[model samples]
Target: MDLATRATPLATTTVHRAGRLRTGGAELSWHADRTTTPVVFVHGSFDDHTSWDGVVPLLPPGVTAVRYDRRGHSGSSAPGRTVIHEHVGDLVSVITELSGGSAHVVGHSYGALVSLMAAVRHPELVRSVLVHEPPAFPLLTGDPVGEPMRDAARAHVITVAEHIEAGRTEDAVALFAEKVAFGERWRELFDGPQRAMLAANARTFLDQFRDPDHYALDLAALAAGPVPITLTVGTDGPPAVRRITEILAERLPAATVHTITGAGHAPHLSHPAEFAAALARHLDRTHLDRTRPA
Candidate 1:
């Protein structure tokens, strides 16, 4: 993971278009409008709606970028002991409420996994999906080569979970940033607010792993679904992330792969302009003019 030639950080914009959606005994907080040509941005673990602050403002004019704080993170309610499907359901509900049934979904890490599951479960709600580094670890289980990777990943997960459970959330955040998100450069990359956000939501990361199907995905169902997909990876990311992206591109019938040069796990944060342009291209090629905003 080389950080010597990283792209200049984009200027952060303050978007005050905050709103809340009450669903299934929990409240999901989100930013931006419910306009036509909606592109919902789902943030990963230890993150909130502002994860897309750099990328959202750069999208084309016709595109409405909706970024939400996933349930139990940031401004969202923390209903105790939830599963991955609930996150999936929350995403589906967001799309239905804001986009009038269908929208382009851009997700990162765990959020990417949630978006894919929603597409598989309710294809009609997702016009297109552009996901970066979904940790679908179940896809690695049982294979001779993947078994070792899975084992190592499991150990890392347990260590992070233990740190959180022990109330060493700051340590957990630093450990995850070092091992998964950003290499040693996490401290340099994450600003004060970004680091605060990660620390604040550390417990939710542990809650996610409590679900039995946290990393499981039915590849067979995803392959049979009709939703278009653009699976993105960073050139300099961890090998495990690359492997998961390859697995998705191989298993999903309508999936295409995109690579961001000199970027790591969170390109939307590190390489905002490139990430945003890639998303815009995916949406434009979808030819969503039929549902253009009035």
Candidate 2:
């Protein structure tokens, strides 16, 4: 069933009779499958829930699924600056309304960072978490590989913001794509969605870089937080992606790390089957572990 027909868990949440609802700085759109203990997926920058189209069918049976647009992405409305933490708050609301407080959360790229922060900030709501290649740039500050990653990220963000600010959105998106090494592969992998995402989300990316703390998260809080998190990165992914995951995993050594052998940054798009299977297995294991007597 869609989130529209569903009665929300709380009256405090700003929900609309329509398929849209108010959350933070945006009117968000959400979809939900009709099972319990939902698995909520959060998309990265410039993407909406539909990006999970390829992976949804492959999920384990009997578990509910939910996904939503962040502020200013896809069907969601945005009226203010898009701070990353604001996205975190939105995820909290989505999970609250969809799962009545608990869900296995999965997030990709920038969304991954938001998931981690949400787990830390609202530990009661998350059962387990999986994140793919979140660009947690602050983790790389002292790393040899991470330093270059930071430099590249800073350069890319500044240039992209400049272009967007100058009303050169096409040029800004081209530069952003180039920085990510989008190349022919991004076009080939995403079909038309990538271009559309960039055009729709150029301004969001502008505010994404406004903070020096934009990419920074309290890693120690994440490591010490109660939720069990799994960091997933594609083997063929860039150095920065892998390094960020590695640093985070090292900090949370008890947490798991899984690699998709042939995959790249956008594993759901580039390697949907593997990504879906891994997530399904993790959910299975988490359920089994929870049910086991300690």
- Tens digit of lDDT per residue, candidate 1, span 1-294? 111111234322223356899977789997764334678888898898877877865666556677788989989996787678889989988998876788889999999999888888888889888999999887777766666776776787789899999999889999888886677888877888879889999878998978888887878887887888888899988777788788778787578788999999989888999998788777767776655544
Candidate with best TM-score: 1
lDDT of 1: 0.81
For residues 1-294, write the lDDT of model 2, one tens digit per residue: 223212223312222222676877589988776444477899987668878877865665455668887888878888878788788888998888766788889999988988888888998998889999888877888898789877886787788889899988878877766566343366666556567776778888888878556677787887788888888988877777788888888888878999999887888987888998889778876773453234
TM-score of 2: 0.88
Model 1 compared with the native: what TM-score?
Answer: 0.90
RMSD of 2: 5.9
Candidate closest to the true structure, highest lDDT: 1
Off by over 4 Å in 2: 1-18, 181-184, 288-294
Range of the 10 consecutive residues with the lowest summed lDDT in candidate 2 = 5-14
Note the Cα lDDT for every prediction shown. 0.81, 0.77
